[model samples]
Target: MSGDSTESDVAQETTDDDGPKTHSTSFKIARALFGGVLAFTALDNFRKLDEMIAFADSEGAPAAERSVPAISGSLLFGGLGIAAWKLPRLAAGAVATFFVAITPVMHDFWSRDDDEEKEQHAIHFLKNAALLGGALAFLRVAQDD
Candidate 1:
C-alpha cells in the first residue's frame, strides 16, 4: 500500500491520539447528559404508569393508557439509541416527536386558571421546548454525518 493513510488508519490514529479524542469524548459525554434524562424519565413513566395515564387523561388525551406506554417506550429506546449512537436519526426524531406532540397539549399554561399552576406549566413547556431543540440539533447532526 502507498504511504498515504487509509481511512481506517486515520480513524485509528484519531482514536489513539488525544487531540481528536478529546472532542469525541466530550461529545459522548454530551450525548449521555442529554439522553440520560429522557431514559430516566421514561423509566419513571413506566414505574408510575397509572399516574401517567391519569395525568394524560386529565389532559384529555385520547386513549391515555395506550398512548402513555407507547410514548414512554419510544422515549426509552430513543434515548438509549442516542446515547449509544445507534439509529441516531430515528432516535432524535422520536424524541423530537414526543416534545412537539406533548408539550403544548400536556403543558398548556395558557389553559390554567391559577397563576401558580400556569407558571408551573409554563416552566415545563419551556423545558420541553429546550429539549426539542436539542433533539432537532442531534437530528441535523445525524443527517450531516
Candidate 2:
C-alpha cells in the first residue's frame, strides 16, 4: 500500500541519522597545548626545587611540610599535562583549581611592602592568572556543546 511505502521511507531516513558524537578537534588541540604548558611549568618547578625549598623554610614551613608542595607541584603539573593531552578541559580545570588555591598562599601580597617588587610580582601573577583563566574559558566553551 502507499501508506506502507511512506512508513518504510520514514524508517530508512531515521536509520540514516545517527546519534551525537562528542569529538571536538579544536578542544583536543587546546587540551594538548594546555598540557604542554603545564608540563613546562612542572619542569621549571623541578629546576628550582632547592631554591623553592629554601624559600619555604624561610617562610616558616615545617621541615616535614617544606618539600611536600614542591614534590607535589612537580608531579601534579607534569601529570596534569599528560592527562590534559588525553583529557584537555578536565585536566586544565584541575590544574587551574590547584593554582587558584595555592598562588595566593605561596605568593602572599599582604606581606610584601616594597612597591617595585610588589608591582613586578603583581604583573607576573596577573599574567599567570590570565593564562589559567583562558584555559578555564576554553574548557567551559568546549563543554557547552
Candidate 3:
C-alpha cells in the first residue's frame, strides 16, 4: 500500500471527510506578514490622504493625478491581500507579478542623483511592493470565503 500511495495520490484523495490541514507555523508567519502589511497599509492610507494629495498638487501633476487613486488601489489590494490567506498560491503569484511590473517605475533609485532622494524613492517603492503582496493575500482569502 505504501508503495502505491505516493504523496501526490494521497493529496489528490483528500476530501470533505478529511478537511485540509491547518496552516503551518511558517505559513502563518508568511500570511501574517502579507495580511498585516496590507491591512496596516489600508489603515496608513487614511493618514496620508491629504498629504499625498498635497504632494501631487505640489508636483504639478494633473488634477486627475492624486493620491486617492493609489489609495483606492491599495485598499482594494489591501482587502484582497488579507483575504489571500485561503488561496495563497495564486495570490502570491499575482502579487509577485504586480510588484515586478511596477517596482522599477516606483523605486527608480538608479536615476535619482541625491542619496537622500534615492532613499526616499526606495521607501515609497517598498511600500507599494508590500501592499501588492498584502493585496494578493487579501484577495486569496476573499476568494476562499
User: Which of the numbered candidates is closest to the native, going by highest TM-score?
Assistant: 1
Q: Estimate each model's TM-score.
A: 0.84, 0.59, 0.50
RMSD of each: 6.9, 10.3, 6.5
Alpha-carbon runs more than 4 Å astray in model 2 = 1-29, 59-84, 141-145
lDDT of 1 by residue, 62-140 (tens): 7998999999999998898888878989999999998888899899999999999999999999999999999998886
For residue 70, model 3's alpha carbon misses the true position, in angstroms, by 4.9
Model 3 spans > 4 angstroms off? 1-22, 56-72, 83-102, 122-145
TM-score of 3: 0.50
The residue-level lDDT of candidate 2 at 24 comes to: 48
Q: What does the lDDT come to for candidate 1?
A: 0.87
User: What is candidate 3's lDDT per residue for 1-145, written digit by digit as tens?
Assistant: 5478675655644323434422445545766766566556556656676765565565444462543455446544644553446455554555555566546654676678999999998898888776665655544444433
In model 3, which range of ten residues has the least summed lDDT? 14-23
Question: Which pairs of residues collide in candidate 2?
Answer: none
Worst 10 residues of 2 by lDDT: 13-22
- Residue-pair clashes per prediction, in order, are 0, 0, 17
The lDDT values for all models are 0.87, 0.57, 0.56
What is the lDDT, from 0 to 100, of the residue 19 in candidate 1?
A: 49
Better of 2 and 3 by TM-score: 2
